[model samples]
Target chain A: MLKGETETELEYANMHYFFNDNTIITAGKFLLPFGQFGANLHPSWINKAVSNPGIYGGHGGNGSLGGVTSIMNDTGINVANTWVLGDAGRIFTDFYAVSGPRQEEGDHGGGVEIESKKGDNNDSMAFGGRIAYAFLPEWEIGMSYYSGAYSDDGDLNYSAYNIDFNWVGSYSSVRGEIFGSTAETEGEEEGEEEGHGEEWVKDFDKSGWYIQGTWQARQLGKSWLNPVEFVVRYSDIESDFDGSIEHDFEEDGGKTGSRIYYGVNYWLEPSAVLKLGAESTSIDNEEASHTSVPDDRIFLQLAFGF
Target chain B: MKSIKFVFTIIVLTTSAFSIKAQHVNDPSLVAKGAKVYSENCARCHNARPAEEYSKKEWSVVIPHMRAKAHMTGKEALAVEAFLASTLTADVRHAEEYTKPNAPKKSGAELVAQFGCQGCHQIKGEGGKLGPNLDGVVANKGEAFLLKKLIDPKFNNAASAMPKYPMNKDDVKAIIGFLKE
Candidate 1:
């Protein structure tokens, strides 16, 4: 809705058959099961902060992802199961093969990351998976990775690695995500010339990370203030390219540097939230290739999920 | 590096799978375990809904969807399924039977096992960290206070997440007795 190209996304519609009480084999389009964010935390109702850290790669968002972008879900078959440990601690695992990402004309894959694209560009299939260990009822640590060919001829390869974690405590909650990717750029014949620096031919070297902390006022002994959450987050994406250009954002100058956000959210219901926040996004000038400073802005948002 | 990681993932999953075993569907302890799983996993995604709102049919659909969405283990899903199923009626809730006592006075160990107390509190290094370790709980908190706390989790802190089980005085006494030992 924010991008105005409101195309409905049908990311996955498939079948999951349980082999036993602990194992499952699923076919057709399915969740990539990468980091904690996309699989477990992306739903707006659950997210504690207003801005997404650039770890989970995608075309465009408040802050364009750096180093690596995740195509959330795609056509594939997956094997997944959980192993309960001691009494409550358990390790969860997921693995799958998908049609893989395709290299687009421009840098950004755009809002079309999911629904608009149809068929794989190359014959090569992408493989990836995640493994996570959760314990203490409120804390989890995990790692995820993916690799595949995205070029038309299936020569150029795209691969990425991610580590993420989250812990919810009685008085505070903290979470973070970090991911990086390296993709071989498919060269354009038009700009091909000897000894000339062609950006397209340069590998997309991008990486980003962010950490957020949120606390409740329950300790104050005020019931009314307990529902208010104060959140602060710092995130950035730096690479060989710029986000506005690479992600196909319609903005004037496509620069992605670093961002910090301070927000206060009040809960009306568990799913409904009223958010008031301000953010300062600074583009690091040292990274000359993909550099720009977007203006800081304040926002008031009323968001809820059914 | 990628090959090593791929191999590592396989090893973890393969080894974990060997430990999977079929559960006896009628086990009453599942309800207690399910109660813990639901509290731990559900509040992360959305607000907690009372079991009163969902019928057995709605819960059947909800549990599987939640399992896939949150990547819950089959055991976790089954335990929660059993937990919610037991809550359908008061008689069913209280009647969810543990093993019948062979003798008149049930052993403290039996009550702990029946209630799945260690599912949250670490007992002899074999439980979750949801609750404080029971190793020194008896000494720190008196036996009388512990009994009252079990009867009323929010007796002191109104915001405690501890669930109130429909246990009688003898059941509570057994748990306290086991801790004192």
Candidate 2:
């Protein structure tokens, strides 16, 4: 869906499936899907031979700024101010709030994310508010804060903030942004999985951030026929569990070692583009990473505008 | 005289050697030749493409259409097709015509707009319409009639109110590619 600053709104959607070999099957509300499908004969008027992914980058995709506003979960239809100055820079002020899943602290020394009665009364009805400004084209900076309300009426609030900077060069471009999150949660007694008659007063906090850069179109064999772009970023987070919660949970301080991302974007066409990337995150104190997960992934994307 | 002959021979050999050493595959002259052919045989009906809008497929389709409609035979059709394809496929941003240090710059969209073409045509679903709807017209009309119209709009339509723009060989060929989309 598209709603121009001026002009009536339009609605649209795209559904597509991909096979491991990279062959794609697509069907949508409008227009022929990019490649072939069962019982779908291409039109003679349409030159399928000239069909190249590079032609219409993200032509028929759903989401990412072009869709019917009505289809959006309008529970939080907030407003934000946007300003762009020529080719040199841009600035924007955003205000937004939405409801859904939220982070809840679990029992100490327990399976991560599983809630036991003794842990903490952190179940929540959540709400968030943010006011931020960005100066762009090359350089940018920003900040935000959020909070959630627990069922017990006790407060489990957390605040998050960030700063960023970037540069655009002829052959390639680079950018770096840092973020920090701080949380103060009220804790319960030592071994209680369920609520106990006496509630203990305790405070816990968590904070972390990262910086990353990307170099694109560097001199390489890929640059001759196709422009290849590369990006890398590393991030880390640490938390301190305090008071009675530490004794029962057996976790007073926890840290996420570091996460690294390596990504590449290919310019398949003037308007169409594709990105492939992967990430690996190591744990500082655990025998295994979360899910013992492999931080390797590859994806291809295409975008086009009409 | 003998020494002079030796030096001349050496100069010839040296020139030949240097030329061979330069070995810059001189980006296929066939396209250049095709450009000339287009200007001479097809520009009257189809204009060349601007830097951004042309493509190889467009040129290929154009070749056959010109052969069928304008009667361009073997060599002429091939050459014009080559030229049309070159501009269509070359990165318009890096093309010399676009990158001159002091060259007046206009966004490709802006150039398309300035030609007053948007008044009658649209690319990829945008533009006005005093002319035949051109979205993929290149795929249909081929190059012959398009180039011909550039030189003389009335060649195909005695009553066409469109004025024939002043265009040389390269410019006409270039426009053909631009309209390909």
Question: What's the DockQ for every one of the candidates?
Answer: 0.19, 0.02
- Please give the clash total of every predicted structure, in order: 8, 48
Candidate 2 whole-model C-alpha lDDT, 0 to 1: 0.38
Chain B, TM-score, each prediction?
0.63, 0.38
RMSD per candidate (Å) reads 7.7, 25.8
In candidate 1, clashing pairs total 8
- Candidate 1 — which pairs collide? A57-A69, A57-A70, A67-A206, A67-A207, A107-A246, A108-A246, A108-A247, A244-A254
Considering summed lDDT, which 10 consecutive residues are worst modelled in model 2 chain A? A63-72
Q: Give the alpha-carbon lDDT of every model.
A: 0.66, 0.38
The total of clashing pairs for model 2 equals 48
Off by over 4 Å in 2: A1-74, A83-89, A100-136, A150-154, A190-198, A218-225, A241-255, A270-279, A287-306, B1-181
Per-residue lDDT of candidate 2, residues A205-257 (tens digit):
44445454545443332324334556665555554443335442234243235
Q: Give one digit per residue, the lDDT tens place, for model 1 in B42-120.
A: 7554544545456667777777768876667788888877766654544344442534543266677876765556655
Model 1: per-residue Cα lDDT over A164-235, one tens digit each? 888876567788888777766544333445655554544566677888888776556454675677989887
The TM-score leader among the candidates is 1
